[model samples]
Target: MTHRFVGVGALTDVPRVAVVIDVMRAFTVAAWAFSRGAERIVLASSEEEALALKAASPGWLALKDGPPAAGFDAVNSPGLMRSADLAGRTVVQKTTAGTVGALAVADAPLVLCASFVVAGATARFLRAEGREPVTFVVTGEDGRADEDLACAEYIGRRITDSDVEAGPYLRRARTSKAAGELADGVRRGYRGVDPDDVELCLEADRFDFVMAARREESLLVLRPLPRAAVDDGGEERRTARR
Candidate 1:
């Protein structure tokens, strides 16, 4: 299998499986939300879709970039989901990087959302089942961010074809110019840059499953599937594309 890394700017060329990385906060919060008993997650490509889904469905929570909307239950923050009651609730996520990147590559045979939490599982799936020429799409905030690239490298390494480590990579990422800018964004009142999010995004292999996106009617449904179950009827099927 061949592995290539591209920032979100180059989403045109894709492979059978495109693993999108958003380790900073968006997907990390998603893993935690699912672990806390969230029934399902709808990855809305735009804010309008999230609101429309919230209006049409019961037990659905919508989160845009910054905070939760006035009537929603939570935002895309791991710290926020740490104590929320997500049992049997369906979550709707529309974020700056993670969800958008996956939607951009929805044409692929499969789209898997990656972070440190699901890194190991992603690697295992790619190693065992990925077709030749799998690509990694690192979706950064503006152009490219160290945290997302670091996540891509980590997944590359775990695939046994590339070599990158968490220790040195994360250390540099945490202190990189991007990190500084992210902190400044928070100070400037930006959404999705809590210090706690940075901390949560750095952990490795926190979950046994990886999240994948599939197009549902008027929405992309992203839910976690166990790594070992990828070929055993987990059914990462695409619904509809428009």
Candidate 2:
């Protein structure tokens, strides 16, 4: 089994499994949100849709565009998961790139969100389930983000059980052009971006589970892969999803 990589805007082909990478924050935020006991995350195609869904369910937390919408609990911030008491809550997430990339390749047999938090586990899953080629979709901020590429490269190395140290990839990402925007807050403005989120995103295998997506009536509901618990950072819990 082999692996391929594509930028956010250039996902021209599909594979047996599609793992979307958004290490800068989108997917990472979702993983951390779930860690804080978020019931489930509903991926919306647009901010309007997310807001509408949240309006339907009073308690649902919607990560919307612009300043926290009238009643939104928080924006798309991975750091919020650490400090917010989001237990027993539902999150409706709509992002510019990450979610879009996942939906673009939703046609695949499997669609999973990949960040450094689950990079190792994703590689293990690929290794165990090598029946076909897998593709890593690097959802850049818009075109290409250093963080997403770093996650993709790290996972690609892990697929072959190579000596992949998370440090270099992150270092490379930090020094790249887009990563600069992380500090400067280009697309979302300085207040919208959090350098801390980038720091947290660099934590490899931070979660015990990998987030997977399911398409339901045009809506992709994302949840931790069933029983996905990583013992000792879930590295040993490298079971593949069949």
Candidate 3:
């Protein structure tokens, strides 16, 4: 099986398995939190739900969605996740693009969550397993350019067996003014974050876990690939160029 990339709205030709990216904040923060040992992530489609879940859970960390503007919880900053103790903790996250996009594909045969930081790992996992007809869904923010597309391009390169290059998508993402603005915002508020985290998210094929999204009761949960299923395999790898 081969993989193709498409924007969020163009999901009419949904595949059996899909990987969604909204790296700017949602999934990036989720991935970082997981790396920090977060037990699970509850993705709230709205702020109200996220807060409610947090209130109900007492100790669960909460994040609100805000884009084109600041979110209720200081926007999506990796630094914020780093500073907190998320080990074995649960996070309720709401994001403009990430959570909404994941829900849009809830009916997909298989939905995997992804971010820039784990693009390489996602590609390698898909290749090793040979999952076919995979769709790299870029959850765009209000139809504008964002980190989702960039992360898609990075993953597209890794899983595709074709000769097509992901250079154009990667180049566009690197030069996007929006990305620059977001980076600047982060730099201004938190000086310790390496500008390379931004750059690293743009790199192709970096990690090994393919995040999986599933609904647990009413909340959408995302977490790393289970340890037992890491070696599964089946088809040819393909990139979604456009």
Candidate 4:
């Protein structure tokens, strides 16, 4: 089957299935929060909406994403997700790209949440389904590089035909050099975050769960699996390290 990666706004000619990636923060944070036992996530279209949700729900909602200069409760950092006690709670995320990208493709026949953390599981899900055209929507900087592209390329390599060349996309996805430079320029930066997080995000098909995005009430909710439940095969057990 052919696997193509496109920007959020570039999404057209909707495919049967689509995988959305916002690895730097949005989708990565969502994956991390879910792995930490969050019951669910509510994606907001803007920071103001997310703040309102958090104010109404208090501990039930954790906020992320806002102007970098103006800081919010969370900053789309996957590292912060490891520190929060999200057991049985839900997160309200408002990212510039990730959340917007998800909303852009909400009309697709099938939309799945993906990132470096869940790349392996996502790939496994697509492979098991066999030859079906799949789209990996890389939510970029208004459509530029950060981490979303990297996560998409990684997943693309895993599920696409063996001959497909995902190198250009993969290269575009690696922001380590840029991330490192930023870390050095800033104090108390994310230098301590496990490098494995990046590598794990790049691994193809590590899990069996496919997260589907849907509108619940006025919010966006991501649901895992559809009708058929595939055995997790202990992948959940591996998440404890984070």
Writing each residue's lDDT as its tens digit, candidate 1 over 152-236 gives 8878887885344568667756875656765776678766556566666677888888787777766677787764464343344
TM-score of 3: 0.77
Give me the runs in candidate 2 sitting further than 4 Å from their true place. 141-143, 186-189, 226-242
Candidate lDDT values, in order? 0.74, 0.74, 0.66, 0.64
> Lowest lDDT 10-mer window, candidate 4?
233-242
What lDDT score is found at residue 42 in candidate 4?
A: 82
Q: Could you estimate the TM-score for every candidate?
A: 0.86, 0.85, 0.77, 0.74
Candidate 3 per-residue C-alpha lDDT over 50-129 given as tens digits, one digit per residue, 9 for 90 to 100: 77787787778777543323323434666556566778888878877878888888767667788766766676676665
Models, CA RMSD each: 3.4, 3.8, 5.6, 6.2
Tens-place lDDT per residue, model 2, 1-242, is: 67777876777766678889987678888888888888788988887788889899889988854345666667777765677777898899888788888888877777788898878777766665564677888888554677788888898888786467888887877776655656666445655556576678778877757787777676778777533342233432342232
Comparison by lDDT, 3 against 4, better one:
3
Q: Model 1, residue 202: what's the lDDT? A: 72
TM-score of predicted model 4? 0.74
Pairs of colliding residues, candidate 2: 230-234
In model 4, where do residues sit more than 4 Å from their true spots? 66-73, 160-208, 224-242
lDDT of 2 at 155: 85
